[model samples]
Target: MSTQNYLVISALGKDRPGIVDALSKSILEFGCNITDSRMTVLGGEFAILLMVEGNWNTLTKMEESIAGLEQQLSLTIIAKRTEQRDRSNPFLPYVVEVVSLDHPGIVHQLASFFSKRSINIEDMATTSYAAPHTGTMMFSVHMTVGIPADIHIASLRDEFMEFCDAINLDAIIEPAQR
Candidate 1:
């Protein structure tokens, strides 16, 4: 007889070289296969999200191995089985992009707006880069937000436009289908 397996692990910590090496070593120690993974540095923080698979009986051992790594690297780790469902289902998946002069509170304002409306943000990637010629900072946020089928997209667009106007930034919201 064979045991079933399922799990996803994600980690985030201060950005530094060798973090990936440490994480890979830990994963190897646990003997878990990396099914799929993505890692990136955002605003001086290194973040990793990975899907791992192994026998159910070894799940705790795998988690323990990663927990050791977390302590060694001062990382925050989150692990959950694949069967666990995420709360909040915002209808259809859509992408919202905003590019504007970098300033404080941009993410807060946009996220606040969505939260107020019960929108589920699946994934968001935001970065600040220098503007060409001007050398000033510009912020770019690409968010995958969930929109309910019954929700009026036009109204959302209108509200986004108004919000963009108030913040002096350009916001674009569109349905994201793969």
Candidate 2:
């Protein structure tokens, strides 16, 4: 069997219709599979992260096309070859959610809390908006973390709650529903 090669591609450009179509069409033409992708519009810009899988030659061909694609799509494109991920540690996936008045440092504080415990944050997203009726600017965060197998869940939960309380942020940490 031929070994499959993977490439991680990130593209950013002004928001427009048909960007996804054009990108996906190019990948298909190169005989690559879009194994995973995240596409979003932030303000007036479109950003995308795609993980593509193909045989070595096809991936190389795709890489060679990036410069032209950038011109064609008016996007800044970056591609890097990567190996498939293998989890080295047995860890539980937990989802963390937080809500509070929008302010600086909430994300930083949350990151510090997890980093200090050696937990891995797999994914996260944050948003700010006006609260219903109150017209208050509110910030919310959703994160997925990998908790080491050896850590006691109850103790960690207690400590996390205490940390949130001290910071005056409402939060919850729970095992992810697979």
**Top candidate (TM-score):** 2
TM-score of each: 0.77, 0.97
lDDT of 2: 0.96
**1-178 in candidate 2: lDDT tens per residue?**
5399999999999999999999999999999999999999999999999999999999999999999999998999999999888788799999999999999999999999999999999999899999999999999999999999999999999999999999999999999999
Tens-digit lDDT track of model 1 for 116-137: 8888787888898999999999
Model 2 TM-score is 0.97
- lDDT, candidates in the order shown: 0.84, 0.96
Which ranges in model 2 have alpha carbons more than 4 Å from their true place? none
What ranges in model 1 sit over 4 Å off? 1-8, 12-31, 42-45, 67-82, 86-90
Worst 10 residues of 2 by lDDT: 82-91
